[model samples]
Structures are given as C-alpha cells and as structure tokens.
Target: MVYELKTKENENSVIEFIESVESPKKREDAYRLLDLFTAVTSYPAKMWGPSIIGFGSYHYKYASGHEGDAPLTGFSPRKAKISLYLSMEEGTYKRLAANFGKHTRGKACIYVNKVADIDVEVLKEMIKQSVNFSKKMGQS
Candidate 1:
C-alpha cells in the first residue's frame, strides 16, 4: 500500500523525536539537516514517516510493478545516521557522490552521520542537483 503523506502529524513527531534524543549533538545535527533541506529545496520541509524530514514531493512508478509518491528530495535524522533522498534517475547524481565525503548510498538516498563529517559545499551541490533533477522529472 502507498503510504499517505502526513506532513503535519509527522512534523510534530519529528519535533518530539528531536527533543527526546538526549544528546545535544544529535539534536543540533537534526536542526542543521532541517536547515540545509529547507534552504536548498525552497520547498518548506515536512516530516516524513517517523524520522524523515522531507521537502518537495513527486510520484513515480517502476517497470518492476512498483509505484509510489515520495518527497522529490529529503532526509531523515535517525539515532545513528542522517538519510538523504535524491530521488531516482540513471546517472543523475553518480558523479556528485564522489566528492560528498563519507556517506553510504541506497537506491536513491544518501546516509550520513554528521554534517561536519562531510564536505558541506559538495553536499549543497548534491542537494541542488537533486532538486533540479526532481523538477525535470516533474516536467517530463
């Protein structure tokens, strides 16, 4: 089943979750992630799922018989890591990741532990690329 978007409800939970993290470092990291996502997308950030703070959204379907709507790009601040979504397309962001510093990749998401652990400038470029990529997807 497709997950329903619960922007407001998720935002509240994210606020509470961030507040409950106990570690000031983690809380601050969450805030920074929030700031970066908000600044880059220019789309107001909203929480997705229990931990994900998402920005602009789009819908997609795959040949493998899967389809869904997802944030065009976003991230989650987990207890142990931060997750960034870049959406999906062939070769769109492959080169950018090389300079992104320490990170792990899933199908369309990048995971990081802390902002300081990566090259912020490169991260910004990746965010720009992802947002632009999403916009293009919307048009096509």
Candidate 2:
C-alpha cells in the first residue's frame, strides 16, 4: 500500500496566508516568525498546505515504510497557538527544553501562544539544530 501526505509544498503566498490570521497579534507574530525562520535557516519561506510557513524541506521514511517529504522547520499560527515543527536529538531537546521558557510540547511540536513568551535565542538554536539534523537526514 502507498500513502500520500496532504501537506505538500505549494505556490501559495506566505505573506497572504499570514495576513489571513484572525488575530492581529498572531498575524504580526506570523510575519516575525517568517523572518526569523528565514534568517535562521537561510532558506526562503514557502507555504506548506493551507497554513504552515515552512523553510527548507527533507525526506523521511518510518519503519512502517511510510515515507514523505516535509519542511525542515516550520510553524503555523493557529487560533490557540503557534505550532513549531523542529527536530532535535533526545538529549539536546531535553537540555534545551529546560531553558526554552514558557511553552508546551507535543510529540513533534512546540506550542507557544506568542513568540514574546519564549526565548528567541532558544528558538533560534532549536531551528539551527533542526535544520542541521534534517540536512543530515537527506544524506542518509
């Protein structure tokens, strides 16, 4: 059997999408994140699916044989919070999460209500590490 991922990269304008964010603050933050992600990864922002603003992409396959391409790092400014998609070694994630400031986590995402609530330096470090890890993944 084959599986397809719904969130493939598209030609949508990232600025337009960010403009659509309902909250003024969220929209502002989205733009800030766009710049931050681009600066950190040195990659142009692309729209993934309808909402997420993504940077460079990487391909991955799980043990179950499900494989797909995904942005190396990305974020979605949702109504409740911004969801950050990043990669980290377990030990590094644990060490960084402590000093990561106020935020919640999921299996593969970090949720922050606003960027100001967390440490931007920590965010930058995580993004840098994730991009590095993803580049390595593409080589393997």
Among these predicted structures, which one has the highest lDDT?
Answer: 2
The models' CA-based lDDT, in order, is 0.73, 0.90
- Give the C-alpha miss distance for residue 77 in model 1, angstroms: 1.2
Provide backbone clash counts, one per model: 0, 0
Error of 2 at 74 (Å): 0.7
Quantify how close model 1 is to the true structure by its C-alpha RMSD in Å: 3.1
For candidate 1, give the lDDT.
0.73
Task: Encode model 2's per-residue lDDT on 1-140: one tens digit a residue.
Answer: 45778899999999889988899999989988988999999999999999888899988877777888889999999999999998878898888999998998899889999999988999999999899888787667
Candidate 2 whole-model C-alpha lDDT, 0 to 1: 0.90
Candidate 1 lDDT over residue span 19-110, tens digit each: 87667887898788778778877888766676667787766666675555567777776777888777545575667766778888877688
True-structure RMSD, every candidate: 3.1, 1.1
Which predicted model would earn the best TM-score? 2
